[model samples]
Target: MEQTQGMADETRHPMTGNRLDAEAEASGPGFETHDYDVVVIGAGGAGLRAAIAAHDAGARVAIVCKSLLGKAHTVMAEGGAAAAMGNLWPDDNWKVHFRDTMRGGKMLNNWRMAQVHAQEAPDRVLELEEWGALFDRTPDGLISQRDFGGHRYARLAHVGDRTGLEMIRTLQQRAVALGIDVFMEFTVTELCKADDRIVGAVGYWRETGRFVVFNAPSVVLATGGIGRSFQVTSNSWEYTGDGHALAMRAGASLINMEFVQFHPTGMVWPMSVRGLLVTESVRGDGGILKNSDGERFMFNYIPDFFKAETADSVEEADGWYEDKKNNRRPPELLPRDEVARAINSEVKAGRGTEHGGVYLDIASRRDPEFIRRRLPSMYHQFKELAGVDITQEAMEIGPTCHYVMGGVEVDPDTQQSSVDGLYAAGEVSGGMHGSNRLGGNSLSDLLVFGRRAGECAAENAAKHSNERAAVPDSTATAAADAALAPFAEEGGENPYTIQKDLQDVMHRLVGIIRKREELVTSLTELEELKARAEHLSVEGNRQYNPGWHLAIDLANMLIVSECVATAALEREESRGGHTREDFPMASDEWAQINLVLTYDGESVGLARQPLPVMPDDLKELFD
Candidate 1:
């Protein structure tokens, strides 16, 4: 590969641009350098939104992603974005949406964030439409809304279950139109800081394995989640806790690390595709869950907390779908944490299907055309992947590792991290979803916070324009050496073997349900895995090597796995995603606390912080 030099432009100071190229050359031979006001990592919905916002704020921005520009994990979202648009129901508004989100998260959410998200989400969705996104519409030619779990009314703005694809398309097109630079297929391994502030980042090109450095004052992390740490997951391979681990290593804190949501409806049959997601739209549009004995078992699992708003019998539950104004919601539309635990209990009681899952039946409940029109992705996903025609047969569904409700701790107003120049948004930022995220909230969260992070970062960059931070030669050299270490070792353990073992450990010991002994054992096992990952060996040279890529990603997985297991052991209560079998009830004491994790150069440390109290004005909405 040929060496690439930093570009000189009006936005870049001449002395600073020359210093960056000289430092890149000193780091190693053929090192590529780029200079920008802000560098946004992970080109998903949040990253793209952040880049566009920064550019609109008069800052030169660049986006770096691990995959192709449009192939982010956001494209796999099958449900719609949640916003209180009130298009289908006049009574629906931001206050009702805020109440539903807080209750769905079991009141553990940051009050200001939930408020901001609910108020801003509707506008963000409208902004996407203005940028050329065509959504499914109602008879009145308004954007149609659909029902989702834990929502009060028809609140999701969808494009026939392919809403994520539409969102990414709209954001990517808008960013490209503004001429923001994009670096594709680049994996950032380390964040370089100067005087305890973010200065730049060091990474390598996935295709040619050459080193590249982005010298920017501000860095925004939008890398998605930590789902890949488990064995069975709906997340793609890129969701390896990269943002979480990077923030911690760069002296930032993570909160609520124990709350990993196991979405209740993933494909269960066809072992090759066990963790593939079955969108909740199947139920939102009138599907039902049944056990092997043909019993609607969700009715048996309704907790006292939600009993006032949930139907008690089959007749009322069925009637609620058509007459939502007069009847309570169906038990199947309960929050995801409640539904997932119900499925686990049924399976353990021998009421599960032949493939160890329950039946999600829409064929017997709705017309065939309705099923196809509302859930086209699911209809084809089953037909092609598992040979099951969802339109005519009940789909086998079970809980799978989905989103993590914990990540880099940031200020609610600015999206800035504890570190001076670091910012986080979307799923990578914590305190937005609290313990468990409701269906359809993830996409809206991306837009609302992604824009805030971008605007704040651009302002910070402008304030420090004359004092551009330089990446030290020693720091750049160390990052390059770490990438090369796997090939230098002979007769070491294979990176693939270590990764599989790590996944098994996380799934079995730190899964949806937890016990004190299992969590303790998981911590011990994670320490062993960490030691093994340090000595991982890959066979081929670095050019397009999958093994080397996995080797680099294992370090991040191990770090985040430890955070999950450690926090799960400490929170002795059952609430949302962090369920404890030993302490099966939600504790008042635990509800007031949030677990926070920080990493020094050597080890991860855990501490407790008080949950933010909602003001009396916002608290009255729940009443």
Candidate 2:
């Protein structure tokens, strides 16, 4: 770990005092204000990386997170970060990674962003290594890469199954060492704009619910996915689409809002941990998917898109695990969208476990020691949560909402959103993954785009710092009033009940398999939810009030759910993560179209835009 800067020399704010855990109470009025060159909202991989990059570029940066540092959602990521280091497969390179990404998204991905991610991911992984991240190593002393869906070869640098933990730790250590100001457990409610440009943000402390202002020329929204909108999800409560809502409300366009990736293997038997993740590493490490009859089911569901590379026969699939050079990759390791659809089909066909899920069996395929060694967290998670030892028995797994493939539309070159001075990265920024994101790519996307977002945000801040030294009090006051509106409502629906109903609506109507009628119904239901949310009333005071927080988060979830439903209704193709049972096949016309959602002051509107054309050199890879 790097040494932390002493308190004597570090930047200090009156609101924070000299201590790290500073607190102030404000119930009715008045709020503290602070200023920074750049404010990064979120403390996950993307936010941490962005803050670190901004600080390193000679900018005063701060990170605002809803949870304590190190407790961000990134720590829950079990599989490795995808980077084409080619340690195991010497022939693998960026072109192959890029090709796989575009193909995995069914060619709906932003070509330039895909190219950039493929080209820059290797260096980002190496940089993490330099910052004291020790990845699994090969016999040759290079970082050992592992197989993952969509990638052509062994190309993920991991630390067992706790790769995200290691990554967040390294980035957190580096950020703390650099003395970047972090307001832990701070939930940003609104992005405050002055002079028609983003100059700061208004949010309340999660501990006290006291509104605070972070004045900066630039803001980076790295707050993650909208998973909590769905009933079954691998997302934490904090993943309620705060960043997406903030950006949309601040006048930025969101792309691909309809595409939500339902990870194939989530714990289903134990009702309490139903949405908990079962890492893709299981399949990458030679696990097989089966139905209740013990039939290898994934083999029968291989789509034509993956037929060339995916093995059809059990012999070839099993052989590929041992010898990748001579045999094809297993169909079980297909991209997340395909695998999830297959699993959903199995369960709906009555070929599922008692809990309405298919079986993920690695126990019968691999030795117990190997299972325990490679997947320690998963081994313990199943053993403790489900009372089933994964080393001895199969895990009952089903699709759960994992990630969003759509978010704030940004320029691929600079990571700048449609709204000036506002930037986004990670799952909050769209166009990289298209209609679906492959496993392992999420981490790499964070690193590659987070760095760019930070660098570009810093440049913008430096250029505009002289003009944006202070945010007007009118803007801050309005933001605070809006945030506290829930407290004023006397009789209204409970925020939690509203949230739960919204989740039910999303899961039932706009789920893994979407239909036009269902999507339309979801949109209408979401409008009703939004109306209820507008008058939501909490029972408790603002001090450490979870009810107030939920009320605020509910508003954001409603906004994001509206985007998902609207975009899903507009796009009529079954492609990648946005599977339309009504339009049950990938359409060439829709392939060329990308849905763009904009908050046009009064209402959110959708527009159809053409996909970015790939350059000849990059397009040659597919040919």
Counting clashing residue pairs in each candidate, in order, gives: 0, 0
Off by over 4 Å in 1: 1-29, 309-327
Best by lDDT: 1
Clashes of 1: 0
lDDT of 2: 0.87
lDDT by residue (504-587, candidate 1, tens digit) is 999999998999999999999999988888788898666678999999999899999999999999999999998999999999
The all-Cα superposition gives candidate 1 an RMSD in Å to the true structure of 4.5
Model 2, which residues run further than 4 Å from truth?
1-27, 309-327
Q: What does the lDDT read for residue 9 in candidate 2?
A: 36
If scored against the real structure, what TM-score would every candidate get? Answer: 0.95, 0.94
Worst 10 residues of 2 by lDDT: 18-27
How big is the RMSD of model 2?
A: 4.3
